[model samples]
Target: MPKLLMIAGLVLLLVGMAWQFIGRLPGDFVFKKGNVTFYFPIVTSIIVSVVLSVIFYFIGRFR
Candidate 1:
């Protein structure tokens, strides 16, 4: 449906904006060695999870 598409688009836009802010959070790990690299976003994942949980909790509470 058109409404669903619009909501999805909005969510994508918000996520893209938020990605720039969240991508470099502390406790996120990165390791590099000659010809090899590794990256993890542990802190970023936790922050996002907490944020989304709060948002949904409020939405559900109100509904």
Candidate 2:
């Protein structure tokens, strides 16, 4: 179950990356509101990966 969750998380991250890459925003093709800009989709991906991993880790540990 743990392995399955890890795989699913990885898949989700990959899908998000692809979607970000393929999709475009308005005007300057930006995806930011203020202060920061988003040119790389990998950062969000890493965050997702970390969150998923943590959640899955705890789930596995508890079970």
Candidate 3:
């Protein structure tokens, strides 16, 4: 892939993630009421990864 396209793909990936979550994201917390706790990024990033992968995949195919 060209440098420009590679850069654009990265930019798009960042934008997609930031756009959906951003400040709206909730902070991490734990629940001990039932002696159970969990930790994770509430704002899922799988979509961002998928989109970026797809974009790059096509970019590679076109090259």
Candidate 4:
């Protein structure tokens, strides 16, 4: 449990450092019209999903 928490903390730290770069990746959508605005991170979601999937795959394999 302690090891899991430590690993989670490290992942959060790295994500914070890279947050800005991740937000602006291509395929992400942002729109503005007067006072209304909308944002969706389609590409970002896919990238994150792929990365975590790969990580978990290896973790599962080792276990």
Candidate 5:
């Protein structure tokens, strides 16, 4: 549990540090209207999901 928490924290820290670069990944979308904006990170979400899935798979396999 503690190890998992530590790893999760580290992953979050890394992501936070890399957010500036990751925030504009290709396939992500941004829209602008006269006075409004909409943003969606579909590609980012898919990448994160795959990464977390792989990490969890390994963790579960090892344990």
Candidate 6:
């Protein structure tokens, strides 16, 4: 559990550091009307989900 938490923390840290460079991924939605702007990261969410799924699969396999 401790190791999993540590790895998760590290992954989050790296993502935070690289967030500016990543900006918005392709297929993400952005709406702008006058002064209102909305953003939804659909592609980013799917990528994150897949990556986490693979990580957990490996962790579970090893355990």
Off by over 4 Å in 1: 1-9
Please say which candidate is ahead in lDDT: 5 or 6: 5
User: Worst ten-residue run, lDDT, model 5?
Assistant: 14-23
As for TM-score, the candidate ahead, 2 or 5, is: 5
* Pairs with backbone N, CA or C atoms under 3 Å apart (clashes), candidate 3: none
Report RMSD (Å) for each prediction in the order shown.
2.3, 8.2, 5.7, 1.6, 1.4, 1.7
Once superposed on the true structure, which residue ranges of model 5 sit more than 4 Å away at CA? none
* lDDT (C-alpha, whole model) for all candidates: 0.77, 0.66, 0.65, 0.78, 0.85, 0.84
Q: Residue by residue across 28-55, what tens digits does model 3's lDDT show?
A: 3445556665655444455456767887
What local lDDT score does residue 18 receive in model 5, on the 0 to 100 scale? 69
Best by TM-score: 5
**lDDT by residue for model 1 over 1-63, one digit each (tens)?**
786577558766877799997668779899999988898989888877787777668756875
After superposition on all CA atoms, how large is the RMSD of candidate 5?
1.4
Candidate 1: which pairs clash? Answer: none
**Models sorted by lDDT, best on top:** 5, 6, 4, 1, 2, 3
**Which residue runs of candidate 3 sit more than 4 Å off their true CA positions?**
1-43
Q: Tens-digit lDDT track for model 4 on 1-63?
A: 887688678767876777766668888899999999898888887877787777668767886
Clashing pairs in 5: none
lDDT of 2 by residue, 5-60 (tens): 78778777876776677564333334676888776546555655787788679867
Candidate 5's residue-wise lDDT over 1-63, tens digit each?
999899889888877776767777889899999999999989988988888788889978998
Worst 10 residues of 3 by lDDT: 22-31
lDDT, candidate 2, equals 0.66
Please say which candidate is ahead in lDDT: 2 or 4.
4
Supply the global lDDT for candidate 6.
Answer: 0.84
For candidate 6, the C-alpha RMSD (Å) to the true structure equals: 1.7
Off by over 4 Å in 2: 1-40
RMSD of 2: 8.2
